[model samples]
Target: MPAFQSTFDALIQSWKLRLQDAEAHETKLPARMETCIRVCEESLLELRQWVMEHSFPCRECEIYFFKQVKPVIKARYIYYQKIHRLHTGYFNGSGLLEKERLEKELRELAQYFTDNDQFFSYYRNGYTHHDELFFVRGQYDWKICPEVNHFDDLFSTSFDGKLAELMAYELLMKYVDGMLNPSCKLTEPATVTPSRSVAVSRLQCTASVTDIVELGYALHAKGFFNDGKASIRDVMTFLSTMLQKDLHYYSRLFFQIQERKSNVTKYLDELKAGLTRYIDQLDEQDQLK
Candidate 1:
């Protein structure tokens, strides 16, 4: 009876230790984490404008889905990957790991990435293939809430799609900032582009989906379903107003748009530069005010 009691006590202690480790492993999200969150919020701001403009019974879903969603999703993946690597490194570095450790590593990785596929892959499908998962139902005053099984709720603590996207933003801030804690400022980030001229050149060369989608949505929202304007500059200007709304999203989406171009690196550089400049201007205005 004494031996059994001791074994039970050890098992409880082990379980408690594992739980503590899992919770402790998260660390307190870092400063760059906030940067990531800001980007996510900006994306949603653009998204909300697009949604409010388009609303329902309209054709175009969004302008930048293929262009932007992947990058935003991938940024989250990078954060999760960092966490996975951190946990794995901690276990390996601890030197007490054993043959039984494979299960623990596998379980921890699963918790972060889930089944060896990157978390972004799930988001890529979720954001773009939303129709495959949700539909408008009911007989009257029908709503556009996600289906009961849409994986989006996994990203949500607030249950609003906008809020879920925002959660991803906060998660990003916490994740990256966790890496940059104990140091207050992470003032410099690697820009997607280095020159303003390059950005404007590309901005002239290719059209942003934001412009087109906003035009479409504005038409939908205003009951003006056929005001056809294919001007990229117009979209860019609309995107500008949105940038005025969210700098982080504007910059990320700008990169995503560039990613879609044939000369992706060049375009990305320009777009990156353009957003960096745009955000700087806004930051300056805020400082002055």
Candidate 2:
């Protein structure tokens, strides 16, 4: 039991650190979510494999694994999966229609909690009268189990899956709420001067807004301007003015970049190759001279 607990603690700590790193990096939302989901899957698999290979010395330890440990790990997986679905499926842009869709999803998630209020209350209030039946193998009560399908009699109990869903839904609600009502102050568009307007008019962005947004994010990540103090919105606003393009939805476009399965930094890679070729031409001319 002590060894198992210690190993589980270490696994969770490692998983958390990886998640933090993924979040801290300037990756796309879907990419970060993929990393988070992978980490959770790996951790859960490790725990499941260990439990299957070993027998618990007593019922108390078995209950601890199911009621406390396994459900928490499974909850994390469920949470990330649901979040990934939302970002990939529901979210489009910050337009009225998108906001409406997100709000509707949020309400649906809330309704799930309302539907399962009894189990939620039981779990949240720390009532453990049914721990033996809920956490122990071969003690499942079909009448009370929220899930009827995909039962794993060897490793899962009737209520643990429900518990995991409850926890995951709680986290999902908070995330969806934050999406609908972000706390960050909106950045207004930069005021354009007459001279700046003329210059912007003279120069046009031939590339797609998606490409420009990719470049803007790269520059922001590299701290190319204002000693890295500039927010992404600021950089985007400047790029929009310079290119005479509306980049108000750069964040949404960036999310699209994240969803790409291959060549996520397509534009950035192209830029690098193009610059190298230009330099090579200049070097060849200098050698000829």
Taking all chains together, each candidate's TM-score versus the true structure is: 0.24, 0.60
Q: lDDT tens digits, residues 1-289, model 1?
A: 3332352344335434543554466454443344444444454455445444543332222213322332344345344445454445555555533435443433333343322133235454465444322222121111533232233322221113332333344454443323322233222334556585476456431345444333333443453412443222233334444334322222233334334646534544565789999999999999999
Work out how many backbone clashes candidate 2 has.
0
* Count of clashing residue pairs in every prediction: 14, 0
Query: Highest lDDT: which candidate?
Result: 2
Off-target runs (Cα >4 Å) in candidate 2 are 1-4, 93-97, 184-289
The candidate maximizing TM-score is 2
Q: Which residue ranges in model 1 land beyond 4 Å of their true spot?
A: 1-29, 56-106, 111-131, 134-289
For all candidates in order, the CA lDDT equals 0.39, 0.78
lDDT of 1: 0.39
